[model samples]
Target: MPSTQRKKIVFTGGGSAGHVSVNLALIPSMQERGFETYYIGSHSGIEAGLIAGLPNVPYTGISTGKLRRYLDMENLKDPFRIIKGVAEAHRAIRTLKPDIVFSKGGFVSVPVVLAASLNRVPVIIHESDITPGLANRIALPFARKVCVTFPEAARHVKNGKAVHVGAIVRDELFSGSAARGRAFCGLSAGKPIMVCMGGSLGSAKLNRVIRNNLEKLLPHFQIVHLCGKGQTDPGLDKKGYAQFEYITEQLPDVLAAADLVVSRAGSNSIFEFLALNKPMLLIPLSKAASRGDQLLNAESFRSAGYADVLLEEDITDIRFVHAVQQLYHNRGEIKARMKSHDNQASLRTVLELIMQTVR
Candidate 1:
């Protein structure tokens, strides 16, 4: 058992950077409050690489399989993998005996949550989309509470477990220096900065459109592209255009310099942009590609006047340029509307909720 003097918390989420970002935001604060933290995720999932970037947080890799809706030969084997994952998670929870487990929902989390329940540990889940994903929907019954970024998401969680905690923006992002950002990217300050982010794994769609129209865009805007991991082009260099596979510590700085952003509508990324008041043009993943979560996220932001959306299916090289230019020209008005959102207490609220749950 974890005593108050030396408390422990287990965090589980993976598959995408979005799943693990909340844990990243909360981990430092939890450490500051004297809580020892541990992470449980799939061995080779995106979460492992992200968590590896952190110090002192021991990560436990467990067997986890993708929880898919469509039929596949692998689906037959997944149940066994998930069962094994549950056993591994059970062992991990029994050994750690943390005060509580906080999960940002993903397929990997289902087994962890199940193990936590078997061990009689409190589990809290956070959902970033307007609708709970299949994994979160399955885990909802096991959670003591489900924290949702979107108010609409609460409606999807059965029983009385849903809690609307808003978006948990990373506090470190507030300290970004635009000047430092410009210097680091080696981009000139003469033009407005436009940052294109394609989530963690990179969006091939976003990359192609941006690359194809660089000549048109770079003349008007200094473009900084976060092309996800291993998506950068080495020989395609242009002045006033910078490409990075990912911006780790310098992300805040890069964002600070951004006059506007073009991004996939991941809830965490969009909310951070909203908190920063960055005008945006969102290109959500098509419903054909995703479960329509990003499309919903982008539409919500669009309806709220926080962003302009050009559907992924509608993207053409010229349309991409036109959309970027449109967002750029109207950024001042868009930023003014963005000021309507109040996100100052999101981080505090989630932290407080975690402590209350632990006690």
Candidate 2:
């Protein structure tokens, strides 16, 4: 690669933090390596809100939304919107002429990935769940590289090459050391910390469970809870709960300080915890989600011994408390298991694969 001719990579995906965090991880590395990076996603999705106000980045939007689970009036408009989004993405693709398009699968990335493929530009699909999303499955045949978080997802790709790169993680989380993390997060030198999070936007079910179990959990360890954007204002009643709608550069501190985590098993969260070697009690949402990806992600991690999965419906106050106490008591074993599967350099692995296909 020459210095003057910068490699331009376009990242398109965002409806949830699971989709968005992949780009957040890969983009800085791409930029530091002198690759010109651009992000293409929907203005309507959470990407606009999260990516807005960030520096040294350019983003363009295409109209995009999820397809409903059950047949509804909304389905009628999706086809037209898909066509419109593709045309808009085609315009963006022509204008940007990116060296590669790295798409973390989501409905928002569908048209953009399709447009890139149509233009003969290499499209890389990164599926974060064990089971591919519907949109990603539809777009998989056209992608040059179908990068996946789990080995099991390889079964879903029919035409493209399936490469398991683990998960791309932001450097901040990747670099947080335990000792410094405790000091930074204001945790006592000896007390263990439990970090609870629901993705970027937060999970009401997880929040409710934590609230109910907080009193029992408080005596065991300090809690650093990421309540998600807008959801924190309802306020949790725990004596030592540190609440944040978003944790910026300090996330590494939070991850390092935690001995255990109770969170949604979204691909980003699961892999981040795995990289940090943190024990987690993963609460995957019901199969009734527009897509059942979360449940699949949880199952994969549980099977891999990286985390314990508990269905939200099956979780009770006593069960949640017991899981926390049980995991925290055996922290050494849990952390060791997480370390066994940790691929901290996964971001580089993913970038290398994309580079291979594109170059």
RMSD in Å for all candidates: 1.8, 2.7
Candidate 1 clashes between residue pairs 3 or more apart in a chain or in different chains: none
Error of 1 at 207 (Å): 0.8
What TM-score would you give candidate 1 relative to the actual structure?
A: 0.96
Give me the runs in candidate 1 sitting further than 4 Å from their true place. 1-5
Best by lDDT: 1
**Predicted candidate 2 versus true structure: per-residue lDDT over 1-359, tens digit per residue:** 65576778898888877778888878887788787888888887778776775677798989875765787888888889889999999999999889899888778899998899888898888888877888788888788778887888888777548888777777778677778766665667667788888888788888888877777877878888788878775545555667777676677877877778989878878888888788888888787763678888888878767777788888888888888888777778777776666576677788788777767
Candidate 1 local lDDT, residue 44: 97
Best by TM-score: 1
Shift of residue 303 alpha carbon in model 1, Å: 1.1
What's the CA error at residue 332 for candidate 2, in Å? 0.8
